[model samples]
Target: MSIKSTAARAFAAYVDRQTKRWSRRPIKSQHKVFQNLLKVAGNTAFAKAHSFNTIKTHKDFVNQVPVRDYEDLKPYIDRVVAGESDILWPGKPLYFAKTSGTTSGAKYIPLTKDSMPEHIKAARNAILSYIYETGNSNFVDGKMIFLQGSPVLEEQNGIQLGRLSGIVAHYVPDYLQRNRMPSWETNCIEDWETKVEAVIDETLPENMSVISGIPSWLQMYFERIVARTGKKVGEVFPDLSLLIYGGVNFEPYKAKFDALIGRKIDSIELFPASEGFFAYQDKQSEKGMLLLLDAGIFYEFIPADQFHEENPPRLTIGDVEIGVNYVMIISTTAGLWAYNIGDTIAFTSTKPYRVVVTGRIKHYISASGEHVIGKEVEEAMRVTVEKHGFIINEFTVAPQLETPAGELPYHEWFIEMDQRPDEQKIKEFTAALDQEMRQQNSYYDDLIKGKVLQPLKLRVLETGAFQQYMKSIGKLGGQNKLPRLSNDRKIAGFFENI
Candidate 1:
């Protein structure tokens, strides 16, 4: 074996040892993490106000610190943005990862020196864990093209602001830097289309063995590469073996990606967000991501069904049960205290704790008592995509509440298709999709059976409609996703006029 491969294997072994040690006693490790976070930031204004010093146990911490969404903590974040220190974390954050969701406007999430390493560590371990599990170390010896956001960070109130990917780009390790593609200047190009083209120009001829990004953006990159090279991804990068993806469900894009790459490749899924790097695919044989129990973040889960309740039952890592969807609440080293990250997830394993991101809490459809989440919608679409033998490039679902006086409300899907199917096939596709939705969601099934809700509807969008919509919202690419399901007609109405 080459020296580079041997070094890679050694690093992977170290990470594997740490991961195994942490996984052996998840609850104990997590408790220590929470206590450490509390001890470190106990003197901060937010922590003191919440009586962090007086908190002795997990229950005490839970009772003292109420679960909060971004809006609830915005006042303190605003102070931080205005040059305040010790408001949240101990001192001013090193940077803020700017993120936006379906319901909220721009949100600035703090990333301090204490918290940034969690992101770095989680990312490194994701790859290293993959290597350790699969015995694939040659990937490190070749180039890795991370199709992330621009590296050029914007300064605001003396704090750096950018996408999490952009911030991470600045911190690529020295060893990996030699094998990472796309020059800093190329990455700094703000326009995603321009940057992607430049990236293709730079990495197409390199010895690329790994590619990582949000699936949709990576799909775009793959399409451009295919168009430019007149060859499949396998031919272009013969050494390519691993595809790292996050931010969206990979199942929906799997078929298209398989076709683009010309072969099935190993993949790793991650649950990284602006708040913290939470989970990653640890074992190839494992179904869901193993929760990063030892990461410097304390986790709480509120049952999804009870998420709207005044005081939902908050569950710690020890209490979380498999198969129950829960909204994740996190208390991070960055000083976020029991903050709801808005994503819903369900545990698939309990011994070591593994979870699959189910959906977004805001990104759900329940206009007529049939609550449909991103997971259900994606599953329905996946079924439809499989049955129809066509690909949905982009899609969103919203309630059609303002139907004609006699008509029942229904869910409407706005789909951007790679190849438009005929009207007959579209009708069959919608029926199959509606059936899948009914199978997945009992509430929706009952609503359909009771004749209270009409069957789901689909409207094929114009070729570039989704892109136009994304650009209109200034969220065209690089981890920005169209909210799959909306309770209101906001997204549907916008698409209608287009």
Candidate 2:
């Protein structure tokens, strides 16, 4: 059947669940809704589109559905391009949100009518929760700027399109649109490369209330505004109340942001993805709480403890524990069911469901081919920075692999310190970091024996260099997370450009 027919069936199924919840029935009763959708979507075709789909019941769904990584889905995406409507839910995909998957390869993630509400709600919930938690409900007092990607779709007829930033604008809920800054339609037409420059050029009143996005990108925007205006950001917009951001740990970036604004900006963390916004910081100082997207998704968590074994134990939101990082698995109205997106998150409190995204499960390197993780690097960096009594402005790590030519594999460190560190202190700190890495991972022993890589090299640049490099690449925003582990030379190239 056509893509439209399939999407209509899927959307109809999603709507049916809403209809049930509207009648005051528990939303959880819709667990069977998707299975019923599969029948209307047609058994063979639905199974074909959703890999290994021989789903018999909801239990089968919970157990039989093997996890999918973006790499595994690429061929199906290629099939969609070849005009195969079966893989894509039947209908014209309103737009494709171009996103970076696990490999840093671009994925044109579909944003159909069925999926758009989830994105809208996520952004909305993040805003509302921040306002409520901070007790700063002056949303209407001044414009709230979202340093997001351009809203313009790359094409009109074909499925290829812009990022979620664009699609979210196209499908914004009427109620939330009023508080948006820069106007969504204007954002759609603006070139991303010119967005930071344009935002800097636009003159507004001194009472801008809130600004939000990735920390590094926001730093770039603040810097540019200062450069052009001959004044600090606070001088330009003195009424700025909060600086909400996400996608990376804020501690490493706090010094620079505080320095730019001339004050400590209150921050709220967000956990957003192409498919949906999953969590956000509920309080000013606490980590993010998993605000249940009861309206859009069903969540499942795989325990980090069981994650290493061949067979892992998966838990639902109901079974979650405090302080244990788990691999998040979610089923959303958008299309995915029992999908593992590779995010590693830890709950701080179970009563309110507060959690923090600690790292990506597979987004790290190891010494003996054992997987080293993002959290490990983050903890080590946090400890080293604190111990040195110097704040880290920005940083990244890349594993330098050894070749047969008498070289050893070692980690190359790119550190942007808040101030120039003394050489002696730098040496002492590097040694401490090396020791920490060795303690955490077994590969350091091999390196010490000259069996693996060399000792990690620390390359500390001036404070603002990393920010300058990110801006040079047109990534000035709250959405651009700094790449933690640069396996290849891409980050090294970014550093070189600076």
Candidate 3:
């Protein structure tokens, strides 16, 4: 390793040690530490600049502060945008991580100098854990690739200085800087359309080993890599040991990825948003686990059953139970207190706190008076595909309420298959999907008996097609993801050309 890498690795080692030490604490003690961190960082009037020394206990913080969301904090963010230094976290607030949600409207989330370390630390832990699980740490000896957003910070005038991906690119270790593109830094080359093309050309180099990005974007890149290099992913990047991905679910995209690589590539999932690096997959087979970073945030959960309950209990990490679905609420060093991130999760177990992302609390379809969740749809789709002996490359389901001529309410599946199957096969597949839905949800069964629910409508796409559409639209990147369901009548219009 070069001198800078040596120094960086040393810092990494120290952080890893600290994290392992923290991870060893008894469950309650770890939760206490998490709570204390929040109390120190969450003072309402004084939270703009936190003093870590003042916070002592969870009780002190919980009682003093009420749960808050971005709507509640908008005024503070506005003041910061107006160049008020003290409204947000103290020190120079460099820029906000842009995010949008139902309640937040549009958020320009504040990021401090301190944000990168937490982000990097959680990432490193994820890497180390994957390495340990797969026994492939040595595969990282070659050029490390990151497919991220350009680091260009946005200005008020609608001109962007640099892409966020570029910002992350510039901060790469000095040793790796020589191995990367200097052209990646110049903001003058603001043409992202051309930059992406050039990056695709450069990525065809022989030495790159680890590749990371959102699944959709990475799939596009993999297509480019194969086309340019005339080699499969495994042949071109023989040293590739890990495929790190985040920002969306990987289940539907798994078959497409395996086909590109010509085999299974070890993969890890990152559950990060602009707010902070929330969690990362710690093991290969474990989808998305909560690798809790106590140093950064305090976590709370509201039971799914009690989500609409008045005065519902907001249970801390200490109070979490296995197999329960809960809405994740966070208190972060970045000054979000008991903020509902609007994501729901089901804990597989609590001994080590494994969570499967259930769905967006706000993003669901209720049709014919029965609510359908994202996870339920995903599971039903999984069953459908398995029964058909085929795999779903990508899919979205929209609920169309039909007063079935003489039957019950049903669903319409807008499926993007990796390859086409026969009409008979499609019928069998939809029947299996309906069976899975009936088994999982009693409401669907009741609706079917009442002839209020209709049978599922299957709309299949041509192979390798939707991807090309997304590419043509210039949305093949880290933050952009395929919409899972298009409920509007425009869905037909959108797919009519396909």
Q: What TM-score would each prediction reach against the true structure? A: 0.96, 0.78, 0.84
lDDT of each: 0.88, 0.65, 0.66
Q: What value does the lDDT take at residue 258 in candidate 3?
A: 82
True-structure lDDT of candidate 2? 0.65
Where does candidate 1 clash, by residue pair?
none
lDDT of 2 at 359: 82
Best by TM-score: 1
How do the residues 45-157 of candidate 3 rate in per-residue lDDT, one tens digit apiece?
A: 44633343455565555555556668876776677666665444544355566653445455766666666567766777787666555545555456666766666566753
Give per-model CA RMSD. Answer: 1.6, 7.9, 4.2
Judge candidate 2 at residue 61 and give its lDDT.
Answer: 64
- lDDT tens digits by residue: candidate 2, 349-439: 7555668777877666664453566777777777776677776777888776644577766788888865777899889989888777777
In what order do the candidates fall by TM-score, top score first? 1, 3, 2
Q: Write down the TM-score for model 3.
A: 0.84
Better of 2 and 3 by TM-score: 3
lDDT of candidate 1 over 3-22, digit per residue (tens):
98888789899988888898
**241 Cα displacement, candidate 1 (Å):** 1.1
Q: Name the runs in model 3 displaced over 4 angstroms.
A: 1-17, 26-64, 100-106, 155-166, 178-196, 227-230, 285-287, 402-408, 463-478, 486-493, 496-498
